[model samples]
Target chain A: MMRVAEGSYAIADAVRCCSPDVVSVYPITPQTHIVEHLSQFVANGELDCEYINVDSEFSSLSSLIGASAAGARTYTSTTSQGLALMFEVLYNASGMRLPIVMTTVNRALSAPLSIWNDQQDSFGVRDSGWIQLYAENVQEVMDLTPQLYRISEDPEILTPSMVCMDGYILTHVYEPVEFLDPELVKEILPPFSPVNVLDPEDPKTFGAFADPSWFTEFRYLQYKAQERALDLIGKVDKQFEETFGRGYGGLIDTYRTDDAEILLVSLGSIVGTIKDAVDELRKEGIKVGLVKIRSYRPFPVETLKEALKDASVVAVIEKDVSVGYQSALLTDIKGALYNTSIRVPISGFAAGLGGRDVAMKQIRKIVENASRVKDEGLELETEFEIFDVNPECL
Target chain B: MQESLFAPGHRACAGCGMPIVIKLVLDAAGPNTIVASSTGCLEVTSTPFPESSWKVPWIHSLFENPASVASGIEIAFKKFGRTDINLLVIAGDGSTFDIGIGSISGMFDRGHNITYICYDNEAYMNTGVQRSGSTPIYASTTTTPIGTQSPGNLVRKKDMPAIAVAHGASYVATASIAYPVDLRRKVKRSLEIKGPAYIQINAPCITGWSYADGDTIEQAKLVVETCICPLYEYVDGELVGVKKVRNKRPVEDYLKTQGRYKHLFRAEGGDVYIANIQAIADRNAEKFGLLD
Candidate 1:
């Protein structure tokens, strides 16, 4: 049924439809409504799982790690410091190869402790070995919730995953989202039977100590599973689209880059605004296109190369900065093009941190600067530029 | 051969009472048990590679999340509709009394069907005798060494078994490796209950406590006898079982055996510290009816 619903409630309903056997939750801003709705569902007999209200995000993820190990489909939601508090168990979940799905409402990490939106929290633990997926809208949030489970629980890809959505932009916004039929979700998603579980009938050890001899191999196996997930993600998304009537453009969603002179790259909710700016630029006869990256961890290097092959300059627009250098997404995008046949100049513009509005003017400036850099053969002094920096504050 | 869930080929330190308590608890738990261990001595020593001494299912994750992980396993079994297997957690004092308390409290608060056994060695033994929250008052550790300006650790030891009971654990017990029959009976009784149960075993550390090579059992007995670490059980918020000490001794008997407390006897104004330590034992004796 398609109805106007808040993104959090929509996601909660989508998760309930997936029928997770265990839902562990610790409330944090922009992420609370998702779990709140899920808890109510469990309370009212709409969902039939053990709903645990944990004391902290640490325990929330830790319990999920345990539940996943024991062969249960588990889900949780958190943002910003909540995700930061869960940092250690994040690695444990993936290292143990438990296919727990988490909805990470993207928000900025704190020293000043802002409850605003940014990709910093999700990007901070990029190397924790979980598959990362960014959503551009509420519909994507609802659609991708079940697909994430399929990809994470796939025998070839038994790794934990985080479905990242811009905190308030997608998490709190109301939109009409069409949920896939519950019958279809059950038909498509199989019952979780883990390859290794804590079964006393057939006892086996999990997360056991490995010496120098076997330690590297364990990590290597985790890495290999991720490498294999690159293909599995595309297959799962395609399967989801075939089962339902919608498809997110595999790993990276490209917007009219066939013969563009400039490409603006972004992820999460800002991708929607960037797409709007791209349309306005195209109507003005400017050859500007947008590429929305959906999967960030198993970064779509080949697909990105093929998508941006014809662009003369690519401008990366994102929400997180690596403190002293280019944004994390920009760095990965540049690395994706390194030593390849594609030789287009790529630059980054970081904006919309701490929930600051990413104005269309800032995105247009990115396109205009990249176009000028290509036309006049000029090189940027810095690796990437900070978009919309207030010189008055400096 | 006796039915054993924990094998003997692992590399725990000689005279380390933790492994003995672990073996006894697991034996009582039986082969139909799954263990979630925190990162500490037992985890490091038992599974040191492709080799593991655990005869049943076991998992070792971070230090502060054994109870949370065990809670997950317990809930997972319920989700799978299987109630036959026993869910057990084994963690050190650092994990139990300090870092893992919040998680343990959460596990108990949620009322999961699992038994958590904390092998209390007082200090962080695996990390080379660092002072932890469970380290006794005025006891010396590497981080709380006796010096001219220092009087060892300043804080009192956390009463973990009471903490479990306060968190509404259905069964909470304090046991010692010195009394194997009592420890085994406590473990069996905890497993018999169908909710969160906590059993804290005062397992003495030979290296950390600077004790004799074979005095682990002796020291465990002395602490219980002195009421410094009383052996008692709580069932549904009521203290029903108490291991009454027929020959209660002064706290000096237990303190004299540990080198960590040696400074309290030899230093200037040391008797004050000794009296303060005895006061702690006196309070426990009064509270648990140990002297009677």
Candidate 2:
């Protein structure tokens, strides 16, 4: 059915279709409406589950951990400080191998306390061992959420998953989205039966103390599970496409990058604007392209290499800076291209931080900057340039 | 087969009072129960690797979220369509009175039907007897040591049961391992309530209190008899069971048995600290009507 809906409501509807047995949440901006709609669904008898209005983000994640351990499908949502408060239990949920799914609405961290869109909050904890997937629009947010439960609950990869969408950019925007039939979702995602749970009839101890002799082995298993997710992601996406007839480009998507001299790389809603800029630049016969990455954690190294292998110069644009070094995604790209012989000058631009608008003009400025670096044989003055930085006296 | 959900042959200090409280709680909760514990002496001592002292399902994660964890299990079972499984959370006093207070208070306010038991040993016994919120005033601890110019701790014990009641818990009670029947009855009664229930047991630490191995129960009994730790239960914001003291003992009788309070008797101007301690006990007796 083609219907207009906000991205948060679309995710809420998708979550309802998955029949999560428990939904625990504490309201945070940009993520509030997702849980609010679910609460209404539970209240109006549209959904049959336990809806808990936990006191804080800490308790929300903690309660989900318990519920997930007791063999119930669980869901939650948060952004910025809410996600920061849940930082400790995020590792606990994954290390215990509970198949809990969460929606992380991307927002900037606080000191100045700006309730704005940025990728710093999620990127800061990229090493926390969650399968992180970024969504570009309302349709992608609706379509990609249901596949998370199936991917997370696979016995080979019993890890938690985070479906991150840009805060207000994606969550508050309305778009025409086609929701899959509830019956189809039921057929695709089977009932959740965990391999290990807290059952009194068959008692077992979870979160036991692992001493020096065995602690590393447990971490090794967690590492192995993440390693397995790379393949599992492809299989799940293929099965989803086969059943639903719509497939997101499995790991990374490309637009007109087959024979381009310059390429732009980014993720989330910013990719849409960058793609438009790429098209406008290409009309003038400039050999430029765009590669939008969807999955950042199980990073698609081979896919990135294949897409940008022929480009003369590559530019990475992101909303977060790593303070003393380049942006996180740019550092990751450098690492991925380390051993490969595809040596092209890759420059990074930091834009749209703290909810500042990343207009098409700024994106064009980024493209021109990359073009100047390529044409004049110039090295990047800094690791990455802060786009639209204010001058001293201006 | 003996019917104890918390099994035996685990590691704990000799005359440690926590296992007695655990056994009483499990006996009252029966076999159809799940236990969620926090990081503390009981957890570290009970479930160390390949051997477990738990015959029931047990989980121990971080130190400050057992109540939140139990809330998860309780709701999960509710969704699973099985309401017969009793969920119990057990944590030490440090977890209950200090680091975990926010999580536990949230659990109580949300009105989940779970029992949270805090074994109050008055200090962080597992971490070498450091001071905690539940540590009594002027008691010697590793963190609040006795010096020439300084007595032990400068604050009074945090009134956790009162805090629980303030959160509108369906049931709140203070029990001691000194009286098994009273403790068991409170646990059973608390499990009957339909919302969050809290039972704080004053389980004196043998090593931390610097008491003889055989005097755990005697010390616990003295605490109640002297009105230092009154035994009482509250049901739905009403006081129901306030144990009366037939012959009230002085605070010195309870204070002299432990080394934590030994500093008061040995140090100069220590009589002032003892008078303050006596006043606190008198206040407890008056507030709870223990003299009646």
Candidate 3:
């Protein structure tokens, strides 16, 4: 049934459908409403799970590590500084192969401190051996919830996943979300059957210290599992679509990319505005299209190459920057296209950072610049420009 | 001979008190137990990949997270209806008294049915004898070594047991490796009592304390006998048990045996520092009524 609900409630309701055995929670803004709703569910006896109210984000993820190792399906959610606090535990969770799922309500990192919609937090932890999935809207966030659990808990792909939704933009926004039936969710995500666990019947050592001789192999195994998840992510999304009748294009979803001369690549909710800009540009006889990246981590390199292969130029737009270098997505895309047959001039644009609005007009200017690069045959800018910067501030 | 849960093929220092504490704690917890260990000498020595000394299920997460991890395991077990299995956390002094204090406090305050045992080696022995919150006053550590202008560690040990009690732990105790019976009894008792329980065992580090490998037990006994490290128990916030120090020895006898305190006897005005340490013992004796 469809219900008009806040994004946080919808995400919480989606989690309720999965019926995790343990939910460790610590509150941070944008992520607070999700956990609060989960707590209320537990209090009302609607969700039959152990609700652990932990002291800090560090403990929240730490407890989930233990809970998952003990053969419990576990979850937690946080954003920005909270996610930064959980940096160590994130690597630990994936290294232990615990299959814990978390919702990273994406927000900007601190220093000037803004609790606004941005992907900087999750992007900071992109290499922590987790499968990262980005959602463009409230409905997509709700839909990706069960898929994350299914993909993370797969027998071959026992990796943790971060289902990232733009903080406040998706978490605080109200939308009509189609809640998945708990029965159907069970069909897609069966009961968690762990391969190894803390059990008296069968004793096993977990998180053992690795010596120099064997440390590389341990990391290699984690790498191999993550590589395997690239295929499993798409397979599971296909399964999710068969059950729920809604499937996000497994890794990279394309809109009017076929036979397009220019492609705008981006992730998260900003893809919504970029798509609108693509439509406006197309009406004026400019063949601009949007390539929405749903999964950033096992970074759909092959699929991305295919999507951008036909375009004359590609514009990589994102909400985060590497500060000294360019945007993370632009860097990754540049690396992905390099040495491959897909030779196209790629322009990197840093937009919507720290929750600065990335309106359609700004996206149009990005495309207009890319159009100029294509028309003039200029070299791709090595550094990304802040898309909507006010020159007066400088 | 009965088979021990904590096997003997690990790489602990010859005279280390940590393995003894681990063996005793696991032995008391028996076969039906799950252990969460923090990063410390005990964890590194016990489980070096492809070979583990543990016979029962064991997990070692990060340094400051065993209490929180054990809390998760305890609740997970509860959800599985396997409350019969004892959930235990074993960490070191550095992990307990300093970096891990917040996580431990959270575990106790939340009231999970888990027994947390800190094998107190007094310093961060795993990282080359650095000073920790549990390091004794005026005791020389790498970070607090004797210098022209310095006098070892300046501050006293943090009162972790009292802090545990303040967190509303159902059972809180202080034990020593010299008395295996007392240490094992506390572990078993903590497991027996429901809700959160904490026991800090004074496991003397032969290397960190700069004592002879053969004198690990002797050092353990002397610290308690001098009233410097008292053995006591609190049941539900009440002082129910105290190991009285009969024929109490002076602090100088204990301090003279370890190189960590040898500087106290050599430095100018060192007698004043020794007098101050003796005053700590006197306070502990008076507070816990340790005198026979």
Which candidate should be chosen as best, given lDDT against the real structure? Answer: 3
RMSD of 2: 1.7
What's the iRMSD of model 1? Answer: 1.0
What TM-score, over all chains together, does every model reach?
A: 0.97, 0.97, 0.99
Segments of candidate 1 deviating more than 4 angstroms: A378-382
lDDT of 3 by residue, A1-394 (tens): 9989999999999999989999999999979999999999999999999999999999999999999999999999999999999999999999999899999999999978998888899999999999999999988888888888998998888999989999999998888889889999988898999989999899999999999999899789988888888898888889889998998889879998877898999999999988888888889999989999998988988898888988888889999988988889999999999979887888888889899999988888888888887776545442368678788987
TM-score of 1: 0.97
lDDT (C-alpha) at residue A38 in model 1: 98
- The order by descending TM-score is 3, 1, 2
Better of 1 and 3 by DockQ: 3
C-alpha RMSD between model 3 and the true structure: 1.1
DockQ (model 2, Cα): 0.77
Error of 1 at B48 (Å): 1.7
lDDT of model 3 at position A236: 81
TM-score of 3: 0.99
* Model 1 C-alpha lDDT per residue in residues A1-394, reported as the tens digit of each score: 8899999999999999899999999989989999999999998999999888888999999999888888899999999999999999999899889999999999999988899999999999899999999999998888888888988998888999999999999888988899768888876688787778888878887878888898899899999998888898888788888888889988988887877888888999998888889889999999988899999988888998888888888888889989977789988888888868898888887889888899788788778888887876546423487767789976
If both were scored by TM-score, which would come out higher, candidate 1 or candidate 2?
1
